[model samples]
Every structure is written in structure tokens, then in C-alpha cells.
Target: MKKSMANGIENDWPPIAASRSARNTINPIRRIVDRMKISPNPAKEMISLSIGDPTHYGNMLPPVEALEAILQAVQLPTSHGYPPSFGTLDARKAVAQFWSRSNYQVKPENVILTSGCSHALELCFDCMADPGDNILLPRPGFSLYVTLCQSLGIETRFYDLIPDENWQVNIDHLESLIDDRTRAVLINNPSNPCGAVYTAAHLRKILLVCERNHLPIIADEIYADMVFPNNEFHFLGILSENVPIVSCGGIAKRFICPGWRLGWIVVHDRHNLFKDTIQPGLIDLSSRILGPSSVTQAALSHILSETPESYFDDILHQIQSNADYFYHSLLNTPGLQPIMPQGAMYMLIRINTKDFKDIENDKDFFTKLICEESISCLPASVFGIDNFFRIVLTTPMDKTEEACQRILEFCQRHIKSVT
Candidate 1:
């Protein structure tokens, strides 16, 4: 072995050393957040649109009932104990009841409580695919999906999500990528980064392709019910019964309580496919982890049962307003092309590199913009794309406006001379 000396949060002075695992564990989102923290902005305060948590905004708070439930749960003596590996019966039952619809009902047994949607993903990959197996994922999507799969020795192959078609999966591309070693297909609806919600018809086609390939569907619906105007959020469960679907979601986004760290994985095995294999394996995997907070799980029943539809409606409305304003403004700017988001709290704005006489690429463009405008957005290359960056629409209206205005100024400054 060579030498390891004070790299990141890993090995420090005089320590035995950091493992190779610690050296390679990188989360792109956190990387941007850390840079934003360390980078000296001449401006008073830097505005960041880099993080995905909805609760970061002061204006958006979790439901009053959910908050009260947490308070009550924290007081209960039983809340201090460890949560069961699968989850509390009440929490699992609430999940089943909340997600269950007429003719598409799921029993409490189907829900496996997890620390968060990310942990839910870890468990799904743990059960569905072994080392050396591969899974198909959406390009320009959540980097966590790729990180989680790769960390466990499970490989990932990305398929393009058609930008012009509202970020729907290119079924042809998807079908072509499948082979004997392929194990599962993962999708995020009301997609993160792209903000494109898949239509029911399109979802069916994707599911059909997976079914033909005999692979399981790992649907990351963590943005569940955050759908904005003109688009309906389709639950993957309702679309297919023949194929096995692992729907991952939590109180993080919907309830605006990401810190609560309460999430669940509901196995929709209509045909009893994963009942014996993956289902049991998920329990074993979850067992190895301490699992979600007992205090959070204790309150999950009340939170899921009582949160009003009006609460979700208001949250969606705010996301819609911010996204629309940013999209239109960026579109009108000289050196920018923004893809209007149909849902979620993100939109990818393409940097018109040809319009910039001085800037080199997306990285150079964003670095300059960050230092000059006191604003931070994630470069698209982190999510497996380039010439684009993502903006979160969860900021308050006034700040959202200010950030967009700053972005326009940056774009206008770099306008190349037209012959």
C-alpha cells in the first residue's frame, strides 16, 4: 500500500488509514453543498438551489398533525426502543392503507419500513440483484440510484430518457439494453433533476418491457403526490399486476419532514413472485441495519392517516409557481434554453455554450456563475449529462425571483458577438 494522508473526512494524521470504500464513497449532491460552503462568495450570502430536500425552505413546513404526532410519539416510553426490522405494525398498516386504492389494495405485510427512501433503495438492490448483476436506470436522473447500486458491487447501465417527450423512457433503448445478466429496471417518477412525470401509458410500456425481460421494477416514487398542474402522478402499482414492483416513498418529500427519516418499501407482488425470494431477503437485509427511527415510526400512522389533501395541493401549487417563473425567465434569456417542468421541484436549464465567448463548458460556466452571482446549481454531468444544470423550485417566491434574475445577468454577460 502507498500512503493515505488526510483526504476528505477519511484518514487523518497518525490514524491507521481510511479504507478504499471510504475513499470512493461520493455523493454528488453533498459535493456541491460542500463546495458552496467552502467557496468564498464576495456577495453577502450565497443562494443555493443544489439540495433536494423540501423542508429546507422556511415557508414549507410539514403538516401540523404530523408535527403534533411526533411530539406525542417522542413522549411515549415505547418510542425509545428499537423499531422492528420490518417496521411497526401501525406504520406499515398506515402505509398500506394510504397507498392502497380500490381494486389495488396491499396488505400491511407488504410494507417494509426503512430509514428513508435511500435506505429503501439499498434494501431493494440487496434483495433483487447479487454482485456482478446489472440494473438499468434513467440517465440524467438521481445520482443516488447509481451510487447505491455500484456500492454493493451491483453494476448499473443507464438508458436515455427522451428530453423532448417529457423525459419518458425510450422503450426501444431500454429493450436493447436488457441481457441475461440484467436483473432490474429502476425509474423515478415526477423525476428528480429532470422534473418529468411519466404518463400512465408510457409507464405501462416501460413495465411491459421489463415484464418481457423477466426483471423486477424498482420504482422510485419518493416524489410521490408532488405532481404539479396539467400532469397526473401515476402509481406504478396501478399500471401493472403481472410484474413485481417495489415502490419506495416516504414522509420526507410529501410531508416536508426529511429530517424525520421515515420511509417505507411496499412490495406489490400481485402474482406472488417475490414472496419467497426477494421479499424474505429484504427482511434479512433490513435486519442487518438498525432501521428507521422508532419515534418517527410511532407517529407514522397518524401522519399518513390525517394529513389533508389541501396540504399537498398547496405544496404542489408553490412548486408550480416557482418552476413556471424560472422556466419562462430562463427561456427568454439570450444564452439559455430551459426545459419546462411538468412536475416535481427541479428543471434542467441548458447552458447555450455557443453563446458564451469566454466560458469553456458547463463546469467553467457554473463556476463563474457561482462566484459572480452568489448562486449555486448542480451541473448536469453529475447525473450523467452535460451542458445543463438543475434548479430546485422549492425556494420562496422572492428568493426564487432574485436567483433567476442573477442567472439572467450571468447569461447576458457571457453573450458572444454574432457576426
Candidate 2:
């Protein structure tokens, strides 16, 4: 056997290691997205509709006041030091004020700010779960929870989200999966890849299930403010007190500052179950872990406290128009079944690979489309659904039209070639 380091231990793998789950599993979409960096064709211009990045269309500019706050924070002699492990009082209060408008009586004390929603999620997992304790996750959900759980040696079991019926949660299936070892149930409203918003009735069913199981709810409402027609946003915190609920939100999607890397996990248990039981653990975890950027925390006061009412109204209107445009345009395109997205900026469409001779699966379809038409879409296999693709509507209206046209022409060419 090979000698180990000076510490004198022999190991097959390197030290500073993760659990088995972490070592074995890779996020499939992330792997493909990584390899997509370099393109083969010299003349091709790639129109990216795969990632939900809002900067592509140029609708969101950094808030002017936010920049001033960041500048002021950094230049101040006292601001360079580490922020309070739980986040600064000013930032926490601003988060509270922001949530107050939604009628969620969030106290600054209940907020745990971290390095964006990703860290907030990891914090939640650390606080709530132990190895062998699994959490229920949505199939094709955001990979953050799955990744976090794997790293923690906690199991992440998935329940299905029905696609044919407007991507509704299969609550019965969820109930069937939970047991004593199950810690929480995670739901993403205005879902990431699907853009399917949960209704009040859906929330009611989920809340009831959680109450029955004595499990807390992990609600991801990052797209809460980006809602459009036929979909009403429901906050789980507003729904029930029977079970603890941790609601995660950030300025990333709503204000389009993903690079800002600021977000919070708010404890919304009406009965203070989390505060009474889990809050101390969460605070301790956050204290030991590093906090969000001090400069970005400074911007929180401006971004959260002073969001213009019209700014939000215009954003919703733009998203609605874009969703409509993509839905209608895609409906007219053969071999693509566009589910009308009720909220958020994604359109998950089924690719009829059987109709296209060369395509074998979603990956094949997406790869061919990217190589031939220079339009990029995310494969559904990444989202736990095969033979479907997600298209982002963050591009300008004209570019949205052009992208759809390119997809149409590509499909036609593909069909002709197959014949």
C-alpha cells in the first residue's frame, strides 16, 4: 500500500473528502452545461435559452441606489470587517420590510442571510437533517437540495410533479413516500424549469400532508414576484401554522442580480416551532459558516426597502407578454408541445423525437438543435423528464421571435432530412 501523508494514514481516495453520494453522483445538466462552453462552428452565433439568466435581454439594470449603498459600505472604515454571522441588523430589517409587503409578518430575528439561496438551502439541510434522515424533493427540481443532501450523507427521495396536468404536485405520491426518518418536504413555487406556479389549493394539500407527517416545509419562492396570468402566487407562510415552514427568497431573480449573491432563509412557522426547536441550530451553523458579502448586504437596504411598485408591475407585464409570445409561437411549431407556463421565465416543451429521425432523446435533440441552428435549450433529462427541453424567455421580444423562428426552421429541416 502507498504511504499516506505525514499524519500516517492510508486511504484509497484523497482527504478532505465528501460522502459516498457526493463522490458518485454528478448533476447531469451541470456536466453538459460545462462542456457547452466551446463551440465547433466558427460562423454560428449561439442564442442561449437554456439557463434562466435574466441579463441576456437587458431588462434588468442594477438598482442605482443599491450601488451607492455598496460603495458607501465598502468605503466606510468600519465596513470591511466580517458581518454578523446572522447578517447585519440593517440587512435583516430590510428583509423583514420586504416580506411585510407580502403580508408575511417576518421579523428580522427570523432571518438567516447567507451566500445566496444556495447556501441558505445548505444551512437548512445542516440544521434539520442527520445522516439516514431523508427529505422529500420534487422530481426534476432544483439540484441544490439534492446536492446538499448528498454531501451531508442525507438521502433525497423524489416525488413526481405531473406534467400533463399543468405540472401539479402529486400530493398522494408525496404522502406515500414520507416516513419517520423524513425530515422535510421541498416545494418550488413558480418552479425552476417548468415555470408551473402552485395554486392555493395545491398549497393547502401540501400543507395538510406536512402537518400530518409532522414535517416542516421548505418553500422556494425565488420566483414569487415574477408571476404572470392564470397563476396566483401563494406564500406557504400565509397558509398554515400546523407545521414549520422555511421560506427562501432572494433578489437574484426578482431584481435580476444573480451575481450579487445575497439571499435569506426566513423561518415562517406561526407556532415558532423552528424558533423554539431548530432556530438555535440554524444560527449556530450560520455563525460557524461564513456570511453573505458585506457589500451586497449593504445593497439589501436599498434593493429591499425601496423597490418601486411600477418596477414590479412592469416586470410582471413583460414576463406575461413573453410567456404568451413563446407559448403561441411554440404551439404553431410542429413536433414541439409547449406547456403554457403560468409564471416564471421558462417554457418546458416536449420534443417529439419519434417524429424526428435523428434524435434519440432530449440530449440528442438539444445537441442537434445547438449544433445546427445555434439555439441552445436545456434537455429535460436533467429535470428528471426525458424527451423534453426548457427554453428561457429572458431574451428581448425580437430575439424571442427570432429564436422561435430558428427552432421552427430547424424542426422542418430535421423532418425533411429524416423523410
| Candidate 1 structure lDDT | 0.86
Model 1, 339-393: lDDT tens digits are 9888878999888787888877777766787878878788887888888888888
Off by over 4 Å in 2: 1-25, 35-41, 101-104, 416-419
lDDT at 42, model 1: 80
Local distance difference test, candidate 2: 0.81
- lDDT of all predictions: 0.86, 0.81
Per-model TM-score on C-alpha atoms: 0.93, 0.90
Error of 2 at 353 (Å): 2.2
Give Cα distance to truth, residue 416, candidate 1, Å: 0.5
Q: What are the clashing pairs of model 2?
A: 140-383
The candidate that achieves the highest TM-score relative to the unseen native structure: 1
User: Over all chains combined, what TM-score does candidate 2 have?
Assistant: 0.90
